[model samples]
Target: MSSIPIRIPTASIYEELASARTTPKTVTSIHEEDGSILDYTERSSDGPSMPPHGLSNQALPMDKLSRAQLIAEQYIKDNKLLKAHEELIRCVALSKIIHGDGHWRLAKAFADLAYSYLTVRGLPVQAKQHAESAKNILLRGVDMSKSVEEKREVLGTLVTIYYTLGMSHLLQNNGRESYVSLQKVQKLIADLEELQEKTSVLGKISDKDIALALGRSCVLQEKLSLAMNFFEQAVKMVISSEGDSSAVLIGIYREMARAEQMKGRHEQAIHYLLQAHSICQAVYKKLSEKAAHTGLLLAKAYAAAGRSEYNENTNKYFTESLSVYQIVLGADDPQTQNTRVEFSKWLIQIGKTQEAYKMLQEAVGSETEYSETVAEMLSIMGSIHLADGKIQKGYQLLKKCLEIQTAVYGSQHSKSKETQNLLTALQKSGASWE
Candidate 1:
């Protein structure tokens, strides 16, 4: 729990430095950066006070708290979780010491500490504990404050803490708890809105975010219609701002597509995906990972809906998606290889057997891992070989695919059984394209 202490540079230090400009006759010394403070003597020309008891003293060093926060932020940016945890813990301890346990600043420090544990360290239990502590402190501070602005600040931190708790619960698959926490966030946002103040602490957070969170929670609970309503609200909130906030609009569109797909409305899903793709094109104005991914989603919706144009969009998206995946995730990455296999399946569906065969061959040649990607590629290659009039080669590849499927899915699985039946039929018919 102990951390190395860093020296604080108080706001008074800046004032002192500024005062040095007018008092050039007096000695002005700069402190060395070796963690020491420079002492300054006062030169008040207004003469010595009669009592001197009411004179203000030099300001305390408070910048160390800000410095500690900055250090923790950089540690998080660098993915140094342990260091971030240590620095935030130090900040929290120092804040409690300086501001006492009930101050809103201490509550904020506790919230930051909880975030470090939750996001950086992935320690949900500790994160929840810290969040609870922060919430308690903020509640106490809110009760003690008379001003609405002061109470709002505490309430904002409280909302964020609940949001963190909700996300943590969601990640742990505690759907009911996540929903409850997020519901609290919604309630707090509504309360803040009723204040009719322009400086509402919830300014950065819109109803759209609350709706999206609720929608995702509803999705987890299998309430498709309810989820769709929330997605609709989120979409409505940002639709007018699409030109300025295409990124947000794109995400909402994708979520809407997901809800539509779950409801077996593939055409509607495709509509949302196309809207997302249009935003990606207009906002980015160039080839980007977002555009490529949106293209893939559109292709998927097309395929799912049994559209005749599936192959056209599939081929276009697969080409761009594969290229971007290679550039962003590396050529040999399992994800890139898996994407190639997925693309091959579409190619084979459209009678482009040679192209599919070439793509699978590259995947099989480089990928040594025994994954579903490899097995799928083998199965696709088998079909390609059969199309090319190579029965023996196709049968051999089919057997390999069956073996992998049996190993991965077990012999009793539908996938293994299907592959087994295919091989059996191939043998019985002695099929040959020639």
Candidate 2:
């Protein structure tokens, strides 16, 4: 996760926001070593780092029968998503014909297919459709399983698929929604605990993995204290047996940073981010990117804590982050384009308004999926307009931003609040921003 830098509202604007707090509002993924969503939406080098699963069925029935399945899996492995998707649908149909509905094999095939779309094509709706299809099969299998072990095993797969759907939402930047999907995990955990009354071992495994996944989701929601407890419990499980999980350690550090930052301990936040960064650097380059991204935000947090004191340090970190995004993601990557806009906003604040404008123009030109980014460009330009005493132009630019957000997310979104607050500020100051 990255830091969202917010400008402080003027007193009158703050008053307006306070008054409007009760007014209506509305509208709404990751990989880590050994799990998904430990940290999501960061710079990456174009291929999934998650490992492929090996099919366990050695039955001749599935071998000759799963010929198309084999070819589909290979296509995904080779990064051919469209072809893989086409083949997988065919496989799903054949599996239904041969194994009938809701078979374990059928569910696994659907899960495999959904993952390919979610991770590779970045299509959340398509991913969600297949995941639900897969979940239905898993559910049916759970209901039919006669043995305790069979039921427990199927439950685990169900938990992972639900978690993957949550990832799809996360990748689309809908954190609130991702939380909703994860509610399914809580139900799954409850089911397993009930099962544990009859079988202890399966119960322990289910409890641990669910807690770990839940804690990570809490981290995304900025529930730091809860996340801290979750990670601590998770640590108890790992250090006791798993040993030296740097990825897990990285999460612990991140949660600490968030906790410290929320508590206004900027220096401490920076320290935790640095420690996290160091851990990733030493672990492997794949992990270092997480650290690097946090390091950039660490500096931002520090700047926010003491805006007047560390202006130069803030600029340094911003420049470093820009360099990292450029090198790691290329300028055209959606994440990089967003970062470019973020960097430009900081530039505008430091009196480099023209430079900020130029970068934003370039960003708007780039190919990317995040339209919310356009808000940043317009917001910065509006601020620049206000600074130049061109109140109407600034107000209009910001207004345009609000319009786009409203059209896309509707009137009650968290996004529209930014616009509302800005308009209120303008109304008070006798500026034309409204």
Query: Cα lDDT for residue 295, model 1?
Result: 71
- Identify the candidate with maximal TM-score: 1
- Indicate the TM-score of model 2: 0.53
- Which residues of candidate 2, in runs, are more than 4 Å off? 1-64, 69-87, 102-104, 137-153, 165-212, 219-222, 232-268, 279-292, 307-309, 323-434
Off by over 4 Å in 1: 1-87, 98-105, 116-129, 136-142, 194-200, 203-206, 240-245, 309-311, 323-333, 347-355, 366-372, 379-434
Q: List the residue pairs that clash in candidate 2.
A: 26-412, 29-170, 29-171
The C-alpha lDDT values of all candidates are 0.70, 0.62
lDDT (tens digit, per residue) of candidate 1 on 1-434? 32333233234444454454355333323343454433333334464322111222332224545666787777878978666766676577557656766888888887777766666667677677778888888666356357877667766777778877876777676767878988998887776667654246654456777788778888788788988898888888777655545578888889889988999998889898888888887787536666767877776677677667565776676787788767767766666787787777777666677887898887688545566877888888887778777888888888888888888889999988988998888779956534
